[model samples]
Target: MTPATENPWAFFDRLYCISLRDRTDRRERARIEFSHMGIEMRVEFVLVDKDHNDPCRGIFASHLLCMKKAIDAGARQWVVFEDDVVFHRYDPHILKDAVTHLSNGSTWTLLFFGCLIKGSSKTGNPRVKRIRYQALAHAYAVNRAFGEKILSQPWCGVPYDTMLRELSDDYLGTTPFFAFQSNAKTDNEACLGLDRFRRCFGGLGLIQLMNEFFHAHRLWVILGHLAVLTGLGVCIW
Candidate 1:
């Protein structure tokens, strides 16, 4: 058992990080970050190979697999992180204080270090707060029962964060997020036919064009061009 004075993170049975097989760079970053936080020994890496068809499904499968692994390992409290995770505000007692104020996580179903707030959320304690829904499963903690509960359900696909939120009746999260997704190439993007086209076009051009034009003027110019083309087509017809 972790001593009462120890940080709440000490109570976690293990910390697992999910990374793609090719992302050793991400793995090393986690290693250095964990060592900085003095928790390197607790982290275990789960390497996943991306599925050519869909990476999101691969992400979902990896998370489920982590839950199963934790349960099998008899982990009572555990944390899961994606390779892109970056820790923020590292101190011995910052997170400890939040956990302590929340009755030391006695009522926690899911505890998130990184999550996106939705409309259904209500504001209260920033240190430790209740949340209706959570997204961005970059970093989150789970108890043994919580892990088991998630595993028991019939689930599929990515957007795994939202799925957990729907299943979780009692969830808690940190405000000013304790973790963040690093500004790196996203591994979970599934580029399908139309999506690939959209991405290609979206990133292809027009930084200067967007900067030069006001929103309304841009719209008007586009409309004017369309009208001229329509008139020419009508004349030709």
Candidate 2:
């Protein structure tokens, strides 16, 4: 009898309707191209009503749903991303190698697949573990154990990156987290600037609000997005 093939990753994509409105064709082509490269990835469009009043809620809702779906798929190890981020043209094997490295070597609750920094700084940077933060959910990898841990906790009502910062001290070198630094400046598509929120609250306070929101709402902060979008728009329904 033939042996059953090992289940590939239960990949999750933290997509937004903006992708559909902005770049539908490129997105579809990218998905197909990645698949052809032998990366068993799946895109889960975290739909939120374009009319959902608060854009922040829509964005967060998408990620929360994406996390839940990844867990429901029985994903032990999964990669999460926003549709805006682009991948390197390098061989697919190289990408897979990086994923394997993070998966096996670190206990990082979340591994940034891409980073968008300008110069070199010693702040929370990884050497052998390189993927630095350049954009929002550019690409993050997670394990089922970690996924369950984060999911079980309330959504911290803040961007995922900041959320990691608070938890970073807890898992310093113990968790092998990284960010991609090479294509930080040149790669526009790969970077995530969150133009929407920037237009609304143009100041550092927005970040502060996010952090405070996460602290206050905790899980509900995260879960609120799920309900807001799911109710306002179509999602993991």
Candidate 3:
């Protein structure tokens, strides 16, 4: 195991963390835990006002705000994380190695250090794998090129992770996640419901499928999947 003190990658210097103002306790805990693991971060509080009616919207807005801040700061590459993330068990060496591999590749746009879904063997790389559908925007890194592209676009109503998944040509995820939410147990019920829904109604759900079909240019793939699912439904009926 690599020593926590030395972060091999310079990209870590540009780390930014997003936390809600009212959730200082979670922020402090994350800060303390990350520090103990030798990871330093600049924290930005996402203050939710009356405009942000939905908590999910507030989260997405905060992420966009952080990306803009990174651009203004002249950062070429940066990492962003939510306050609920725990970094104590993260392997800095693996992250650095994966990033090094990705830096050599031209297709990758975003590198997810932590995600809800893992890529299959078809999408696997030596250091990273191309993700199909990743949820949870807990922790990720983006280059300035990708950041600018993201800022140029309007806010799509989908969740942050889904938006990234759709935009990037090759969204990479590490085999062993670099970070994890401290409050994973709290979201178990929600995850169970989502899993059930995905299995029964097809992946991404009907609304998200329609949204992706409309917004993203990759229509044939979505259409093909929908057709297959329709056939299956008809056969079952």
Candidate 4:
């Protein structure tokens, strides 16, 4: 994993891709996609069995395995990506930049390449931002310190991304998304889970939508839209 540049901290020496043994098609797809992005690496397949039937548990177990492997390999930090992840614009420089940035300290528990998160005050660095929520685990990097912390915890049955989110407020995400899951393709749709809210009228659905909406818009933009809507309603009345 050598970077094209002379920078000492440019590329991640240890990178792992988690794939399901049963999903050979996805495995092949991931291999090709990662290769295209110059991420030539080995895939860590997590075979499904009776004990790992639960998708959440399977994800958690796979991540834990990755962490252990990193520790055994004597890697100070490692990058992990799900098989379905698609690199945004497929640039090697961006990935290298993230590797360099997040490698700065052990306090940065996780640096998400792609996620659904509430926007927060921008950090001076464009490559990182404060993450308020993390809904996806498509791509991320963690250091040895965080890996040790993860190993110390018991399996709480929570989803892997949610567990990682609760572990620390130090989680950061790359703006403009370094990578994301390939959801537009039909073959890739199986990994997409049911929406958190099945019905908009349901209390959870409304809350989820509001949260997403508010997080996406700036305060002034939201207020301006509200005023325009109110004026339209009055004019119609």
By lDDT, the best candidate is: 1
Error of 3 at 235 (Å): 30
lDDT of 1: 0.69
Candidates 2 and 3, the one with greater TM-score:
3
Residues 39-146 of candidate 1: C-alpha lDDT, one tens digit per residue: 788889998899767766777788888999999988887899887777766555656755665454455677777655542233354465665553568888887888
Q: Residues 1-237, candidate 4, lDDT per residue (tens digit)?
A: 433364323345577887767777877888887777655554454443323456667678888888888888887877888877776544555655555565554257777776777665466665556778657777887778888898676788787777877887777766546576664332223243443222323432234344444665668777999999999999999
lDDT of 2 by residue, 1-237 (tens): 111222223232332212334446545755653465345244554443432354444455555566687777666666655544444434433344444444455555665544432212232322323322333454566656766766654555555555555443322111222222122122232223644334346422234334333543457866888889888776555
Q: Point to the candidate with the largest TM-score.
A: 4
TM-score (C-alpha) between model 2 and the true structure: 0.51
Query: Tens digits of per-residue lDDT for model 3 on 188-219?
Result: 23246655655465433333334323433345
Note the Cα lDDT for every prediction shown. 0.69, 0.44, 0.63, 0.65
Q: Regarding lDDT, does 3 or 4 come out ahead? A: 4
Candidate 3 structure lDDT:
0.63
- Decreasing TM-score order of the candidates: 4, 1, 3, 2
lDDT of 3 at 148: 87
TM-score of each: 0.73, 0.51, 0.67, 0.77
Q: List the residue pairs that clash in candidate 1.
A: none
Local error of candidate 3 at 32, Å?
1.7
